[model samples]
Target: MTIPNLENNRVKLSLLDLSNYTHLESIAQQKDLIYYSPSDISTPEALKAYVQTAVDGYYHKNTIPFIVFDKISKNYAGSTRYGLISWKDKVLHIGWTWIGYEFQGIGLNTNMKFLMLQYAFETLEFEKVEFRIDDRNQKSRKAVEKLGATLEGVLRSDKLMKDGYRRNTCCYGILKAEWPEVKEKLLAVIG
Candidate 1:
């Protein structure tokens, strides 16, 4: 149940090679992806701290994050990851994902997610993949739904964000048994 740090496939829209801090810092500075309404990353220092946290997490193998690159735009669009892996349960969570505003609704996420799901199911042999989105994030909720994940439920007071209050989280997931059909549907929608 060892998940590789990097999973490459033809469908990958971008690869976030975070082994280099400068690259990660540069990608984080791109405002489009980092400029969401509720986003608290206003300065380079703040972004660096955030990237450092992610880097630390990845280096320790607790989290794996990647940068999203749009082949057409030839620019880094955002970041996504495999977090909170439960090897014994054959489960993994893919959340804390963000795509720049320009890349939204452009199939970039679909392609990236397709690659991730393939790697998780085929390579890591995970039984289930989950996404936990902020309850207030309709865009994310819709995107996950479009990816063919089922909304499981909501965890009230799930966590505290930079804004200093507990945020409710909406859970969505697709099991191994559902991936075939789900993947097909996703391809059709994105293609």
Candidate 2:
């Protein structure tokens, strides 16, 4: 899959690959930021392996991950991805999102989501884009809701977390028909 480089005024989202391993690893190691990350990226070797998994997923047509870059600060903010893509169903899932501790509470997450959502809805013409967050991650749930995605429900014991616990997944989604209003709301906040 050819994941195009996406950028807006505030942020740039580039495809995540092996070459980005070191840079992302450094960001992942910053001040407990990796706690919520799906992979154990605390060390360089572990981060390299994680990146390889994402790259392999891309080759297998299962996922397209991106490195989030802060344009104004000219720094790597974090990472996010479009996973579980279903071309036949015109649907996709967006998760595996992490913003370094320093970058949190700013509008970087909002801007990043806006760029991805716009591309998913307008460029890819997907009928639906989904977000699944660990039920315990209140911050992520709130962030996804702020983007105008409707919470569908929760999937209990959906997957095993890195901590060795079965996590309940909170599911949310934005449909194509709802994109216009969502886009407007996102733009309003981004402005």
Candidate 3:
């Protein structure tokens, strides 16, 4: 798929597009942001490795990653990706998301997710869009819940995080049928 851009609201999805991993480097400098996810990647090398792996994975399929930025703040905020694409099946997953410490609880993530889900359902016409979180991540789980995605059950031992521990995945999604209402709720909350 072509890299997404703001015009399509699907701007270039890979860091490679934004100056060959420059975005990753920006994220590496944000020590305060990387800690938000349950994983503790405390060093520069660790952070670089984390982003490199994600870059490699996105290259493997219909997946794509994008760096989030704030024009007003004029700084990189975090990273988010869309992958596990099943175009024929009409499904997609959005995760690997993180925001800077200062940006958290400021409604930026909600607004970002709002734009993404809206693009997927309204712009791209996707039938279903999902958010998967580590089951133990209450903050993330609650965040998705607050956005109005319905809980779709959990997948046990789904995959190992970079820390080499197994993760129980919690799935949440908004169907095309539910998008109108969910979008309304998301806009209300984010706005």
Top candidate, metric lDDT: 2
Model 1 misplaced stretches (Cα beyond 4 Å): 1-40
After aligning candidate 2 to the native by TM-score, how far in Å is the CA of 70 from where it should be?
A: 0.3
Cα displacement (Å) at residue 189, model 3? 2.3
Candidate 1 residue 175 C-alpha distance from true site, Å: 0.5
> Between candidates 2 and 3, which one is better according to lDDT?
2
Q: By summed lDDT, which 10 consecutive residues of candidate 2 come out lowest?
A: 30-39
Whole-model lDDT values for every prediction: 0.71, 0.87, 0.71
Candidate 3 residue lDDT tens string, 69-139: 75556566777777787878879998878766766887777777877787788877899999888788888
Structural similarity to truth (TM-score) of each candidate? 0.82, 0.95, 0.80
Model 2, residue 136: distance off in Å is: 0.9
lDDT score for candidate 1 against the true structure = 0.71
Selected candidate, larger TM-score, 1 vs 3: 1
Tens-place lDDT per residue, model 1, 17-106, is 435434445545555453222344446676556566666776666667676656676666667878887878989899767765667777
Name the better of 1 and 2 by lDDT.
Answer: 2
For candidate 2, write residues 1-191 as lDDT tens digits. Answer: 57778998999999999887567776877766755545777788877887888889899888998999999889998888899999999899998888788789899999999999999999999999999988888888899999999999999988876878888889999999999999999999999
| Model 3 pairs whose backbones collide | 4-10, 4-11, 4-12, 5-10, 5-11, 6-9
How does residue 141 of candidate 3 score in lDDT?
A: 90
